[model samples]
Target: METSHDDDSLVNFADDQDDDLDIAPNPDRFRDAVLYGTDWTVRTLLQQIEQGNIDLSPNFQRRDAWSSRNKARFIESVALQLPIPQIVLAERKEQRGTYIVLDGKQRLLTLAQFAGGFSNDHSLWSESAKVGPLRLSGLKVLPDLNGKTYQDVVDRAELGQFRTQFDNHTIRSALIRNWPDEDYLYEVFIRLNTGSARLSPQELRQAMKPGPFTEFLSVRSGDSSVLQKILGLTAPDFRMRDVDLLLRLIAFQTRLPRYKGNLKPFLDDTQRHLNASWSDEQNNVVALVDRIEDGLEFLIKCFGSPREVGRRWDDKRFDGPINRAVLDVQIASAFDPNVRRAVASGALDLRAAYIDLSESDLDFGQAISVTTKSITAIRCRYQSWQRALEKAVGASIQMPVLPNA
Candidate 1:
């Protein structure tokens, strides 16, 4: 739960989140994805995990919610022969019976972590996720088992009687055999996860849209100094808001004219098309990333900080929370080669112009705050900023040419 001091980066960003998961649901994909129910004994499940047959959606595993104590409690639940929730997985067509865990990742991981016995290397999930071997504590019903590790259970030192009992226990599992490409998986993944648990917008997108491009976004979003500075982030957002921010920048850079008010669908379409053609567009995508980076560096130089364009001001310091509208415009505008060049050398200080508008311009304020995701508002923000840039540079800034749709 590493958090940002910036209110908008973590709290406000997550509170507002995105448009909706079902905004672009496809009924066709719903019927196409298939699931079958089965049960696996504790021994077999651990074996499968050890063999690396059970994958934990590596792409979308950027955020983790389970605590060690919670994991220990779940392990205790198994030891007590209490019924645990069913696991859900997607059977890989490439390898029959081998699976990618869609749900119950924590349970499987906990089981693997505990059952690794003495060596952490034997705990497949723990070793892969870099978690240590489980050491149980704080058992309400099983105080006798407190402070015991899996090695203790195996060594016949104490609590050995219950290990065989634990091994014999079975857990229910559902295997999805078929999942055609679409957003339906997002709905099922959300529904199956249950109980106020929702993946952040970009987290869900990685699950729904898996491709080299999506992976590219995930990597680029992590460990970014420029991003950390701009979002006021102490660390990359666990909610994948940082990842979503990169996707938004890419979307608006290439498809701004096509964005008709709805940000969710606009970004969705962009991901879908780009992912399908990522092989051909990899070079172009790299260039786009460079453009955004250069533009941001220039903006930082002009404004004295990235926050100038992204964060709102309260007459003095840049204390106001992030306005997504302003950030997007600033980022999208930076996509232009011409704009970046002008911004880098122009006599006009973008920070001053932005502050002037922020304090005095009613229209800009409304554009940023009211129906901010609306097409009207988005274009209004861009046009207003463009006017300021052009006025400062004494020339019209041409928009970057985009690839054919």
Candidate 2:
């Protein structure tokens, strides 16, 4: 695992602690009349799975966390006609007729696997073992099911009745049809998962809010080649820390001046906009990603391996876990097409300028200041970096400014 801070850059945006804001209080606050739907049977739910209606690859939690033994227990529970907990699903209005799994992924997956062989896609199914006859064991109440596979139960004439009963079993499901407000959906996800286990905001956001940009981030962060070359990480953080860094870079580059003190809300708003699936925006995303890659490559060529582009960024003096503010400013600044051209054409003495700028304590300190999330701090840092880059490249490129200023 990469050495991330105990207090991660993304985790400690405003403060290390989460505020106790009373955003929603009751079931009525969820607007149950319109969005809520009643429970569903295991049979009906399986039909939806077969029809390709439910989304299993929500980028939130690791899939198939439950062991085969755990799956066996659940399958045994179903056979005994036990009343399992309800599954919660969020209907994706934007995708039109698609639903994402919010909770009960394990239970739903167990039921499906028992019914049919596992699918090849690991995301769709919970476990790695391909769809085959489910083998159940370690049961206490239903001792007869011990060491029995699904085929055994189905083939035996005497046990045939048991199979029929198991097939007719039901599991409750709560459908959230319309989460009108983004904040409301955020709150709902937090609320729903609190009882079972705590899920980080990033995890919930990835699962609940699946979109084009989020998908892009997932792919970009997962690319080991890029991550290994630039960030100096042999293995990516399974918790998706790299993804968070990429998001922070995009937010600062595109929406820095408008940034308020809070990072989560700012990121949330930016993500909602990016999720709109605009053709032009998609093209721009690709371009920005390419520019970032090019910039990182340029740094590596100039400075050699384990290229430290930030955190006291000089060829000789580079050390420390890559600073967040430094990373944001440098990567965002590198997105300029003119900057890329200058480096390529030898117009920019990037090696000398970058090393010189790194040694300037006065300039770098302002950017990596204590209250770094504030608008003043964000703008100051970005402008400082941009000015340095412009000077290095000898270009009069116009930079983005605050709307009012």
Candidate 3:
């Protein structure tokens, strides 16, 4: 399932230095792996899916796979016996019979979704969501088949007396097994999805770095309704844009000591370590995330509405729309001890104090808006916050010192 970019409500900046970064293939090394082609009739493929042979979970899909119109056109081509594009899959190393999709996940899902009644626990990203039958529409080549279900097509061909080409056509597929690691397969996806469905940095990071920490991040990001509301997300971003922002928060809150101005490598380094030590570190990780969530909720209280979370003042008044730069500093402040005390105690008139500081502190004002990737900008936010929070709470709030600070 592919998601449109409009869902990302946060403002975009040219920081993070990640737009052009990628893990290039190791040039000095070569490895051998087995690759072969296979055929699958729709019925057989559905059977495999029902039997849990294929993985089409949120992690496996490109999210919302494709639009209904695109799916209908593809189904029409199948009905016309046109040569469809090849699908690619990788045979699981431990469980050879089970497979994970390297490419063509949506095509396979489309087949299952159109078939109707196809149910698998992990098929779709959502737990309650299932692959129900789709009514074919917008069929250009096969206008006659439009609005027909799979069974409708079958029954029209013959109510037990005839058969349709759709019921028996075989899809071309290639299966690669004995890959060196899952990372290699993810790289395969990076190469395969270079067209209209290129992977975002967060998406690529998710693929390239697979671990319990990443899995934990995925689960929490999808399940946290409060977090979703803060980000104006009713559901998880199919493109993992919501997840991207959450990752930034997690990195800043938990690993500010390791930040080196470049967010991309800093996040990558932190995730790699936490992922490897998740078993021993999970409890602490959960606690940190809870604190971060606490900070998020506290901010909402200050603004009086979740929708106003990332909102800041414009030149004249506090009328600017929600943006990512505001979120960056706000999230970074979540771990401050004084803020935590305010969060725990429900400190009074904190909203007034917050607005006052934002209005009076010119440096904090500028830091929350432009060229905010530098140590000066970040330190200004935390340092200025110490004064505001100390005044509001009537106590000393130890500032969270960053590496370059």
Candidate 4:
């Protein structure tokens, strides 16, 4: 789902055209079909199974490995005339598979498992004893015309007639695989998935986009061990999704305030800017991350016991305190080259100074007042240090310290 717009509005450039098709055709005539009120049957399922078209992407809900209670409840829903979710499937003319599941993978898996006499528990029907392959059976579907049940028609059937009827039942299928017709797919996906475990645009992008940076962040932030450590320090209830957003904020050094839950477009724009502004030596992103990491080490040394800080090195507070310090460091370093040298040579005693300054009896407001003065002093000291270093190195380095903004 690539688009060229902000989070509020998605502007898809390609309309309804096949990926391989070069010719542009009428968009109105090439509409996605919606088939309803038909019995999805065993023969179609078997055909799809044989065609290698069934996609159980991790994005889909977990397999029907539900507890016995949940399985019983689902069966009871069908028995008690409760409305179950309609399965969303796609039918393609070019594809042999009768259906491409858009939704309802769990329900379908449960049905298939039950019909095959596979036990929900770890018994014969479980992995041990291979029960016969599952197929829809004993299903008493009601007729649409009247309230006639499968039992009413069963009496008029011969031996194996029930299986034949079940196999030949008309199954409703929806087709949506037109490459140019992505908007239609997007609209349909949105309509069907909205309000049901609604995934944000950034979340969706993380799933869809292809890039090393996205992959690396996903691994680092999505790891259960890493997440557990982060939670132990910060809010344990904080979602991994939020962590990803914070990473993007740091990576781009965006001045944007705390995200108001609309991060998709912001992420997209940031990625675009990063891709354009990226350079090998002057890679602000890599430099920014390294600086934040260094600053975090300093904060931990100053604010907590060195042991505790190192143990909870990836704490969320590191982002707030240490990352901010790194930002200031970068700003100060720009005006005084020796600030970078001090950072490199450990001349400024960052950890000790940070600890001494932060532990003072001052509220955040008071601390900010002192911090402002301290930063000015540090900047001045760096300018003097740079001149001395320049003289020793026999290379004149100009310092341009900007006035306070």
Better of 2 and 3 by TM-score: 3
- Please, what are the lDDT tens digits per residue for candidate 2 over residues 381-403? 66766778887777754455642
Model 3 residue 351 CA deviation in Å? 4.2
Tens digits of per-residue lDDT, candidate 1, 289-376, equal 8777776776687678666647765557675445566777676656656665665666656777778777877778777765577666
For candidate 3, give the lDDT of residue 188. Answer: 70
TM-score of each: 0.70, 0.58, 0.67, 0.37
Candidates arranged by TM-score, highest first: 1, 3, 2, 4
Residue lDDT tens for model 4, 340-367? 4554565554443333333432332232
Candidate 3 structure, TM-score to reference: 0.67
Give the poorly placed runs of model 4, Cα more than 4 Å off: 1-38, 46-51, 58-68, 76-83, 91-100, 112-179, 195-197, 201-222, 228-405
Candidate 1: segments with Cα more than 4 A from true spot: 1-9, 12-18, 21-54, 59-152, 155-157, 162-199, 232-236, 297-309, 313-321, 333-346, 398-405
Across 1-405, the per-residue lDDT of candidate 3 in tens digits comes to 233435443333223322333445773322566778988876777777767787655454434536788778877777777787888877877787877766676678777677634444445525325334677898776677778877786667443321256657788888888877545665676667666444545765675567898888877877777777776766666656567767777777678877767655777788798899999989988987787787788778767887767656655455433455567666655556666677668784555665787789889877776646666777777778677777778877664557685
- Clashing residue pairs, candidate 2? 117-131, 118-131
